[model samples]
Target: MWDTVLIVDWSGGNDRGASPKKDAIWTGVARAGQAEDPVYHRNRQLAEAWIIQFLTDEHAAGRRVLAGFDFAFGYPAGFGRVLTGSDDPFAIWDWFAAHVQDSPKANNRFDLAGQINARFPGIGPFWGNGLARDIPDLPRKGLARHGHGIAEKRAAEQQAKGAFAVWQLSGAGAVGSQVIMGLPVLARLRQRFGADLAVWPFEPLTPPIALVEVWPSLIAKTIAATCPPGAIKDAHQVRVLAQAISALAPEDLARMLDAPGGTAEGAILGLGHVALLEQAARAPVLRNDCFALPQGVHWTPVDQALAHLRQHLPPVAGVQPQPLAAAAGQYLAQDVTALRAHPPSPNAAVDGYGFAGPAGTGAQRLTLVQGRSAAGQPYDGTIRAGQAIRILTGADLPDGVDTVVMQEDVQATDTAITFQGPLKRGANARAAGEDMAAGQIIARQGRRLTPADLGMCAAAGIGQLLVYRPLRVGILSTGDELRDPGSTIAQGQIFDANRPMLAALVHQWGHQAVDLGRAPDNRSILRGMLDQAAATCDVILTSGGASAGDEDHMSALLAGTGSLALWRVAMKPGRPLAMGLWGGRPVLGLPGNPVAAMVCALVFAHPALALMAGGDWPEPQGFTLPAAFAKTKKAGRREYLRARIRDGKAEVFASEGSGRVSGLAWAEGLVMLPDAAMTITPGDPVTYLPFGSFR
Candidate 1:
């Protein structure tokens, strides 16, 4: 059962700025048992960050989170394969995450729509570009284009009249931009939370976090009639919808997540049908205050921000019985105890003669038994007092042999052996189970099996083990200005560096690296690949399209689609990271810059991936070192500088600029500066993280 319910009314337009306004991003969050007023934000950035923090807090409090975003999670079915080269519905989210660039003052949604239209022979499906910008292929009116390639509305919308088509990007009740822009956020959230986050319809439901598409218009009349005249209508609608859903039993939400025979595009989760809204319209909207945070709070502490991830993000992988031969790097699902003693019976620790009891002071001579004992072969008869049997290292001690004397310390003759006096009992003789006892646990659950662990397991007579499945991480990238590495590059395009680096990073982390493929700046193609990616991987790591730039599609697409949680992480090289769920998988949307992407992946994603992979959250262990150079920065944020150890001190890279990819090669590790404003001079101690430590 969901312990927390959140309703979000998303807007695709630019930031509303410090003032309260209608048609902005508004959200209503209510615990399953509580009623609350919806919260409001001026822009997607703040709203997303707040939502993420809220979700994190709820998870920390052991609450199951269900968030409903007001947008289509997908476009029509044929539209997907036509636009993205895939039939999976969530491919659109991937498409949007790759191609849509957005900022408060501007966005390329209309341009993206125009680009999508150009992919078809003619524009007939999408319509209405009300923006002042003259997009090439997109038309100003629905009638301007013809030869419809796909249906204008989804099956869910067809059952509910007065619902606007997903193609309507402008004019009254258009939700096109809001939709594609909202998906990347979900894709990111899926990446960030890993197995802990899930989506509706496309994937099975899971606890802690889940996302569902919503439409406030399903119950707009019910909310409008009951709201006070002065209140913002967007805020009022979300509050009412949240109330209706929260009032429902747990099974009702489950049914919505698994809508039967869902449409090719998406289904609005508000009422499941127009009739349900009609049935609930008579109930008045309530005014209640729910979860609220202090206004204007920004720049979360870096440690506090990323530290909470492991505490709540549970492992999404399942257990499998794997032979020790193939279980390296996989986490254990159960303990592996010893099946037999390491040395099953007492044996000679050294090549020596064995006899019963201790020897008296002074050199002593004893007669040796006729037969000798070697590894895997033991003397058949028991040794009597004053007699010794020849033994080899690792040979089982014969009966009555309590001690052994090394051959190096004895003079041997044909029938007798002489050794030093005052030999202690059991000296140089291995007792049974000395190295390991039977029934002793050799390795515990959730331990990442290493070469040593496998060796120990083998010695313990364990041939197979139950291990958690390795996390499958999909790596994706997007940008028109980007071209594949080693490909012929155009004048303006740079080779794609992020995807390859991230894929390598994923591989280095011991998780399965899935190349989700790359797409040009077009949205439809990206969507097809994204849907394929979501279907293929458990978590995704996307570099580029993660920032507020007009070309940043990853974060924008997620805002209104799945659950987008923006983190205003206070750190240099990387500050903002987009996290969300797309089609029930986790996604971590990283900065476009290569340096920032690598740093963020190390600082945040590594431990997160480990925890998601059924292993303990591991923090990089760094050592303090003296600084060979001096530097200073503002105190509010922590900073990481690429540096190398020179003459026993840390020497920073020539420049602090992130674009200097050469710096990454030049430095051996990173020197971290604390949050306080302080200058580092030569001889000052600072924390240094070597590249090896992260892995």
Candidate 2:
């Protein structure tokens, strides 16, 4: 799908009649339409003209033209080699060199191989025998010294507008060249252009007359001989090769196409087509389907389950605890009625207070008479002329007393207090209904009891609270081989860990866990226990007896009861889990394995209990983590893996097996590998459902 090409000279020109001669001219070309086919020519002038015309025409058409030529854009010494046979082959090289070097009008130029090697004297061809030999680094160098002559030429042609894609083939001539040269170019291109670019390469070689008939055979043989054994046979080898070629400049393509030994442009095009096909194959596909319920089964989603339980569960009817205590500071309220502030009348807060005065005379002083009120009790008598009441904080003022003078501002004599400061009528007094009026609703139903609520109710004179009863959950383990802890463990018997685990889990949800004890493997015994549990408990939870074995009586009993909602879910480990109602009570039957039982209980039991308690279900939350190792799983089954986060990434604890308790023990949380994921690799992001996400 890419529209540009840059061809460079690495094996030299094909003008010397397919001889062993190394004479080659690195040419740059950009074309929108096909050019005239090449004819046998001794002079390299035609080849040069074809390149210049292709580039000029493509540029004129407003298409992005990528020109690939031979030369290390950085160090000249690392440029690709040009084959030559003459005594002074440098002359032909100098002539071709003059074209690119002297053409100042050329724009957006890029050199592919050894064309720029003159700038770095010590560097050599990367793929030749001595590719690894190091060279001295250049200093204070600009574009000319960097050997980006072709790129400079192309830029001049572009008039300095858009960016250029330059491919620097690092490894090409010798052993290990495929990877060494390909990886660097691919990595840089991906970094610059993202992963969407298409790369194609052509290998060209002019064959000698003696080898012309066997040239095709020789090309394959030489490739096989030069590549390591088994390299060509590797499944990923082609992919790697394509990725490498994708990084080369177009000039490299032209130079290789002009090689003396072989040329197959069609094979290069095919490789490119295959690469595109592979990318398409990697795209994801989706399918749409609804969750199915088993025949005659009445399963409901969690939200519906909650609503059903709430509607069917019987409400508790009983006397509730009184809101307040009786002793001093112990009981703030004594009855069901709201609280009332003291002083059925008006009151004063200061001392040396209160007497009634005429309506017009403002300055008034009254005699200190009776000490009347406190916070809880009100003053009863009235105040006469020139008489005032001595009041304390929150004390009620007597009738006919409208004002009071501060004790500090009154001069006290034997039987009377004289006022030094003038007093205004009704000063320093408290009025009725100032703090609270009666009959306001201070507390409501279904509200969590907080200290503020309690205080507000107390202030409003509420003495008792009407709170709902806590849900009671029954926990039963249904395995015959199970035994409670603190008892002697006989051979072939395991401790009843599930019972305590389930009980503690229920308690954690703010519900009472009614231990129904472990039931034997007999159907009648299990039925009787479940019946009794359903009679009193809001929900009944049992572990084991839900699998396909003959001893798995839970599913059978549930089916017989005609109230079983769902027998099996489309999930792993917990697939045998059964959700149903027994004797009008909700029942959750979990798998026998400890981990499976625990996980299912967290996922389903917690929500069911919260529903029974008249609460809403919460959604599960998880984080993203990179998979620690590659994994392959069944295509249509969602698998939950108990894993731990390591180095800020997810790592499965161990291979998941329903019977493996050690795996659960080592896990920090669960990793939800979806059903659609067929395989996972390191660094692949996966949903890390932490243990906290469950409960």
Candidate 3:
């Protein structure tokens, strides 16, 4: 039996500027000893990388990995003949792989669908595109107005109700885009992994990584009522499915995978639907398919293949010396040791009379000494027997004198003093090195010097210190639709919010904020801007044009000219992060949506810049507060809800969208939801992080 089961609720929507927590693609994983929580992915490119990395890691640990994707793996049998001149289901996969254009920001699904529709007798067996994407003949909505387009339902869809036509590319119930977009990725994965991957029903399950089609709706109805309110509907569905599979008997799971079936688009996995799956899996493998795994080949898991990638991450930047006066908030590069012992020599801790041997105890009269010991003006001579010196606080303790009696505790007359209270030896005197000994470590490297820490350094005779220099951060925004905030707005243009906001944030974090301004949609200009930023700044930040869309020139530039180190992180309000090196300097590409841009800047870029500036990475510190709202979250990805503390509880925004900047503006802080599959309720303690902490 597989030790790890992964389920993905695939999306065909434009996820370029989506919130990570609620994107079109939601992935849930269930490990033998782990809790179920789904992780969200906005950019399919990054998602692919993460999936490959995850599977590689899991297999390296010797755990069996079973993954499911929610989409039609193949079209209805006859349609494959019409589309690819063959009944072999894999022909369509090969066709898509040969033609589909996919990137971090965009895809060619609509255009390819139009071309496919043109080849058919009439309007699409494929249809639907927004007004902006209107093709020559396809209708924007509803059924095909004309054409001999085939509408035969796939066998799996016929088994399940409310299934959409594979011909519809836009609107509700449309799986056309998904098929066109998802198949290409699958083909790539199949080709990349070769014998290591197997597509269920189409190929024999001899490999370690098995790709299966899943219809969440098939088992979702059974657990709909059991799911808690406010929980993400899709997340709950995938979680329940993974849970059911993990709870099944090993023999039962094997039987389900071996189930027989007729048409592709694949079988839905569920313990309740085991009979159907077993029949499908056991069905004779389609030998006629253009794509098939070779028999008798061993496969490597994704986890094992990518294991070394994690260990060879880029190192943090070098350190620089900074003066003590300019070192506030800067991380120390070296340890600070005390120059001399605290209270160099014994001194009076109180204003009193210093005498020999405590004046022999109890009410003894002592003659006055020749000198008085005051702060900064110590008595040079030693006190003789039966003599006392008048001393003030912080004055050096004279030789032969070990105790001090406050004036209030003794009666003083001309040239003499009479003790009224008992005096102990060394009373009211601060000893040398009592607070800190010489050569003691005052602060260690990587510690951000605080006010109290600075005071300590000053007292230890440290007038200067070594620290990391401030990081020079350059902010840039792309897209022709973005204009300066105060500029006149034309039709289809919005004021740019990311550049100014990120620049201010960079400054607030004590880094040099270099405004590279906005780059137009032209690739060459964008490349020029990036080069300039790289020349002057240590790190570069940009929003928009990071997706795979054709107009997304920033991504094209990075993918073509620079090295892309990271593409996506499993986080909410921030998912699409294009990280790489440009001209030997690091760059971070944020989503175009303002709220997402801000969230990603804080969560991902801030810490990275800090590290490059020779500072220790800071983790968000949170406090537990009662939840005023209820929610359900998937495991594997972290999310932050724009929320505020109200009536001593955390309340999330009424609307949740990456574009909702007003909600972020209204929020005082963020409610941190961990990467765990669980439900939260009112009055439950949730971790809350204030903006002040991050800023």
Candidate 4:
């Protein structure tokens, strides 16, 4: 993934004479998750120098840079071989570097085209010049232009609509001059970067500086919608494109930079013929790994599996603004900075008498003022040296007030109050901005806001918050021997317990659960159910039929159609875990047994759902307590024992089998054991995870 993105609109014309007009040289720079306005340059030389410096600084800071230039990087097939005797595109770049005579505002691009045409027979391919005088062998129009033993359009240009051929030099949408001038800049950048630069569609993208060709016309609608009125289109194109690409999720950006389309003729970064680039910039949840474990891996550790999920999973929720009252329990889409400070001024911390006192004075009796200072009312005049005013709690401390004595400590008479000794200076006095400050980020992006967080936001003068919509998780139960809770169970069938429990869990986690009811073990029924779930839900949760067996139709159908990954975790009571994508929606398959299903949901699915719901990855907090009973255990994997706190010590259930559905109801928490063989004695420390923490 790139840490910085630089998009440039190259110009072939001479200096536009300062004052920042359109169609000169515009470069947009996006870094650190923010994009700035495009910088304008009057000439190509100044733009080239500025870009080189920007790239150099970014590389020096150890940031990967992706540079996109809006021009054709290469000619059609066989053109490079005809010009440089090789099919490699770099060979043509070398030729252009050696022959092109470029200055600050003038270049020999037209003369070079005429000279190149002299080598061919009849009228040459490069045509349509704006020269004041006619040049030999170069035609003024394309009617006499020859094919020159090569195709007229590159493969990428053929796919892109309104893409003018590189041969046209003096017409609307002409790119021939731009290609001539831009390639030399690329050549110099490569020379300067040496081993650190990579030109895409020509080589692999393992270097720090990735140079790719871009056509902004592919997303013309997006640019038109985002660009401001009366602004230059060239500058807006580069600026908006940089911001949109920079906002893409990391995995999608890498896919867009897939290289080596062809060495002779380059391809645009995105296909340019399809809406894939537009969708990628607007919505980026399409680049998940289906939670598939790495190749050659099986029975992954729980911690490692969690880490993989955190790395690959993306936020799939849409964003919007809501009032703070309705925004509770939603994930914040942006940072909320304080507009004004809470406790806006200095005030009294408690009810007391206020009067200015001398630095080293002993006890003194003062006259009580006529009026009292309440919460919203203040005394008009400052307290004199011999007079004190009664100040209530939360009342603003008036001017010339240094210290306040508690009313309980002062001996009050009908007209005067007496204090024993000089109190500490500024005692019981609150300073300005004691609670909050302006410009302070009270809440960060991707944070799950609580009731207290809403209160803090309200105190800081924030009325509305931009938040992500709640994730819709579908609860699907698929099993042959499953029945509804109220239905009579047959000899081989049992009532379904996991569906209601999981739906409740989803509700507790601040997500909506779309109950998909139940599907039989038949593949056709399960496939139809999954398809429907994918259409309406952000994530799907399957109860049973997840194993690699004939009756496990969920796994069978997923493997056949979309993608399947059976993640057998190295933990007890919860191992039969499956994750996949059906119709582009994430699906998590849990074990059939009630105990194991609940455990897996808490230990694995909880955090994953939080991430997909656009909140930060939640790591459940656990505390340690002494074990109430002693036991010997050997382990190659971690284990969670259903336990509860008894007599201030952790106690495990009598049975450790997953078939004991009552154990899930009886226990209040789970005790986590590490993957190491050890004997537990009485009073040994054990880690306990509460059920409430999972929420």
Question: Top TM-score: which candidate number?
Answer: 4
Over 4 Å off, model 1: 1-297, 520-525
Per-model TM-score, in order, reads: 0.58, 0.38, 0.53, 0.61
Q: How close is candidate 4 to the true structure, as a TM-score?
A: 0.61
Candidate 1: lDDT of 328? 95
Q: Once all C-alphas are superposed, what RMSD does model 4 give against the true structure? A: 16.7
Better of 2 and 4 by TM-score: 4
lDDT of 4 by residue, 500-566 (tens): 9999999999998989999998887788888778656778998887788878888887777557888
Candidate 3 wrong stretches, greater than 4 Å: 1-321, 356-365, 406-408, 417-425
- Model 3: per-residue lDDT, tens digit, 272-313? 453333222221211111111234423312222122122222
lDDT of 3 at 304: 21
| Candidates by lDDT, descending order | 4, 1, 3, 2
lDDT of 1 by residue, 195-303 (tens): 8888776777765798888877777677777889798888878777776665443433455566765455666784444433333333222112101112465777777
lDDT of each: 0.77, 0.49, 0.72, 0.82
Q: Could you tell me the lDDT of residue 168 within candidate 4?
A: 71
Model 2 lDDT per residue over 94-121, tens place? 3334333212122111232343343434
**Model 1: residue 670 alpha-carbon error in angstroms:** 1.2
Question: Can you tell me which runs of candidate 4 are displaced by over 4 Å?
Answer: 1-286, 357-361, 384-387, 413-416
